[model samples]
Target: MEEIRPDENTKPLTWKQYLVIASLLFGLFFGAGNLIFPVHLGQLAGAKWLAATAGFLVTAVLLPLLAVLAISVSHAKGIYDIGRPLGRKFALAFMVLIHLTLGPLFATPRTASISFSVGLQPVLPAKLAQPCLLVFSAIFFILAFIISYQETTILDSVGRVLNPIFLLLLFVVFLLAAAKPMGAAHQQTVTAAYHNMAFFNGFLQGYNTMDALAGLAFGYTIVSAVKQLGKTSAKSNAKVTASAGVIATGAIGLIYIALIWLGATTLKHFKPSAEGGTAFNQIVTYYLGDFGHALLATLVTLTCLTTAVGLLAAFAQDFHRSFSKISYHTWLAIMTFASFVTANFGLDTIIAWSTPMLMFLYPIAIVLIVLSIAKTAFAGDPVVYFWAIGLTMIPALLDMLASFPPVISQSPWAHFIKELQVRLLPLAAIGLDWVIPAAVGIAAGLLVHFYRKRPKQ
Candidate 1:
């Protein structure tokens, strides 16, 4: 095999090439957790599934596309570049946090846990769930590690083979759900949390799919994939990046709607379950029975494995490049092990803990993306980034603190912050308290930047 070199090719990509990249992005986004989130949201939102899905699409699909475009347009090779204007220390810290959240700490492990929990564990004995989880996760991560061990092969594995099979199986589920309806979605009872605030709750629900975080983390993977096709010039790469992102997110958006409808209608035969895995399992069994179990096992494994490998490959590549002394394989091993350990904590537990972190990181990630895309307007000014990020962090941190489990969040300091947030934050009622502060920071930064640059008479 010969080495592949990227050229300064600025021409438009053929439709075939465009489809391939779109498929790759779609595979990366529509993974294990992705399957469950919107379905689960449907169960929660019930009658308001459409409104809820709209909010989910904003973060789950739209924000992620923006994140990829941010990388391409800003010419950022990775998260480090995206945050470089914030200063080296902040940039490094931000990169590590982003990687950890999107890697072993949450998203990567969720791939394994959700796959096992959904596909197989329900049939096993209660006592067996823990032991089986251990066995399953070990095998899952090992397979993921082996696949991701060779980075170049990830595109082929995900885009060509695994993603297509999972989609086929998913199509069967969707078709059956539509062909024979469980019940009218509009007649289902909306849960209390989503009764009045379905959209906002659904917006926050999108946080669970973790696509937005994965978007920032997958920056190098998408850019590298595009370059492999010889589109290396900034303008060309940005165009392709934005286009592929749209194609991919468009597919994901449709899937989310179908799944949400599935969830809402299932309420006829089933009460809203604690998680999407349960709703999905009930629907599959109703439609396909024991055969569905085998099918789901394969479907879950394929979807989760592809995503796991992609995350591991991206994680190892970025970490190895950043910390050269620690070999790529070593970093891969470290994350793989950590993720396996975390997976055994169970799917619900992982999600419960994940929310707080997602709450904190989502705001920061959004702000960073916005700054990167609008960098030229402010001339790539660090002051703008610093103010925007710093102010965003205060509210983001409060949200994180309040989102934690009652044992922690109910404490004096945490409660104080949450109370203060409710009292003072403009959008606090809707769980978007970060918006006002972030905008104010941007306005403040631009004002200071121009003031400092004005004639010093």
Candidate 2:
């Protein structure tokens, strides 16, 4: 094959080209996790679906899109490079956190639960489901290993094939909801503040999906994809990459909105239960009948299966890179075993434990993304990130402790912080004691930046 060179003088990517790039990113970002969260938010928000969905979109859709843009703008080679401003230790931890979040502890096992529940369980008897799930996950991971080894086509092909199927299933569900919305139409009950605050809540929830971190890791994949699509110049590729991001964000947003609408309308038929997975199954069966349930199960399983494979591949790749002592196969085996154990806890339990930790981590992740994209102004200074993140850490750690107190009774600092929040701080809500600290960190970073830039005598 001949070598292809990127033109130094490239033109802007056309709209058609941009949409394809966006669609590809959207496929990578949207999967089993994307389906349940917004739907649940819609049901809770109800007439307030618009407000809740708005919040949901900020996190679910917008932040991930911002992450992709950050990667493109920074042109970072890896996750650490994008987050390198936070100092070497912080960057490693961020990498570890991002990988683990998207790995066996959370996203990987989630694949198993979502796949089995949505895809496989409907056909099997309750007693047989667990065994069947084990068998299915084994085969699934093996295939993922083989395909990922090739590293060229499998992920792309699975995404291309599955994206349409997933969209079709969603459309069928939405159509059924539209033809006969579940409950009597009620007036929307969204408060002005909730509506106004939608952006922050949505941005925060974006953490649940873990796409922003993935964007930092996988932005190059997108840049390469842009080049392959004939935008082979630096300027053209940059424009194309950005345009694709816009396209992906728009598409994902539309689907999220539609699902939220469905979820809000679904309340007319379903109740607000704590069980997200079961609730999803119930809603699908109710609206679309047996066929809908079957279709949903299949779609969820396929999407989750692909996602599991992808995560396994990522875990293996990152682990091998981080510690060259382990062979790639060893890393895969380690992750697979971990995933099996974690998957047993089930999706609801995982999501429950995950939420509070996410509250602490999400803000830090957001700051990293914004800073990475705006790295030019900061001159890639680690001190700026170090102090900013160091300040944020106090609150993040406090927030984590506040979420689960009994586990850390020995720590005097935790005790002091908890007492301080109760006695002195005016928090926005119970879980977010970190808001004040994050603001302070931002202010500190700006002051330091200007001070360092001042002319010496």
- Candidate 2's residue-wise lDDT over 1-457, tens digit each? 1134566435555677777788778867888777777766666566656666666777777777777766666656567767666667767888888788778777888887776666666567888977887787677666666666665566667777877877877778778877877764244344344455554555455567777767766766786787677666544665676667777778888888877676666665566656456567777888778887887877777777677777788789887998889988788878877887777666677776666566667768777777776667877676667766776777676666665535563377767777876676555234455567667776788788889899999
lDDT of model 1 at position 378: 83
Predicted structure with the largest TM-score when compared to the true one: 1
TM-score of 1: 0.94
lDDT of 1 by residue, 413-435 (tens): 88887888899988786779999
**Could you tell me which residue pairs clash in candidate 2?**
55-202, 58-202, 58-203, 59-202, 59-203, 59-206, 118-297, 119-297, 183-268
Cα lDDT computed for each candidate against the true fold: 0.85, 0.70
lDDT of 2: 0.70
What TM-score goes with each of the models? 0.94, 0.86
TM-score of 2: 0.86
